[model samples]
Target: MFRRTFWFTSGVAAGVWATTKVNRKLKQLTPESLAAAAANKAVEAGHRLKDRAVGFALDVRANMAQREAELEDALGLHADPELPPARRHAAIENRNKPKSYVIDRTTHTHNRNEDH
Candidate 1:
C-alpha cells in the first residue's frame, strides 16, 4: 500500500512539473515573445557586425601607416612633418575663408557656334 502511494505521489509531481514546463514553453513560443526574441537576436548580430567593421577599419589604418613608413624609407625621403609651402598656404587661406552655403541653380546658355 505504501509503495502504491509513493508511486502515485511521484506520478502527480511529474505531471505537475511537465505541465508547468509546457506552459512556460508555450508562453515563450507566443507571437509577442517570439518577436521580442528575434529583435534581441538582431540587435546582438548588429552589435557583432559593428564590432567586426570597427576592427577591420583599425587594421586597415595600422597597415596604411606601416606601408607609408616602408614607402618613405624606400624613397629615402626625410622632410619636415609640416606640409609643403604651396599646400600650407592654400590650407591657411581655405581655413581663413568664410564658408558659403548658397547653391547656384542658374543655367547658362552656351553659344552653339563658338568653335568648329
Candidate 2:
C-alpha cells in the first residue's frame, strides 16, 4: 500500500509541474501576437462602423421614400419609377439650402456610445 501511494503521489507531482511549465510558456505573448490582437480589434471596429453607417443610410432611404410618395400624391403626378426616392429628397434639400456655409471645426464632444 505504501509503495502504491508513493508512485501515485509522484505521478501527481510530475503532472502538476508539467502543466505549470506549459502554462508559463503559453502566458508569454510575443510582439507578433500583440500586433495581431490590435489588428483584429481595428478590423472589428471598422466592421461595426460600416454596419452602423449602412443602417443609418437605410433609415434615411425609408423616410425619403415615404416623403416622396406623399409629394407625388399631392402633385397628382406619377412618381418616376426610375428615380430613387432618397435622391429626390436630397435634391430638394440641396436646392433649398444656402449656397455657402462655414463649418465650425471646434473641440468635439462625444456621447456615451462614442469612443473617446
- TM-scores of the candidates in the order shown: 0.69, 0.49
Per residue, candidate 1 scores C-alpha lDDT tens digits across 5-116 of 9999999999999999999999999999999999999999999999999999999999997997899899997667786633323344344545564444575446688885
Q: What digit string (tens of lDDT, one per residue) describes model 2 on residues 30-114?
A: 6777788899999999999999999999999999979978998898978577886543233344545564553444744446798
TM-score of 1: 0.69
What lDDT is obtained when candidate 2 is compared to the true structure? 0.82
Candidate 2's TM-score: 0.49
**lDDT of each candidate versus the true structure:** 0.86, 0.82
Q: What clash count does candidate 1 reach? A: 0
Please report the candidate that would top lDDT against the real structure.
1
Clashes of each: 0, 0
Clashing pairs in 2: none
lDDT of 1: 0.86
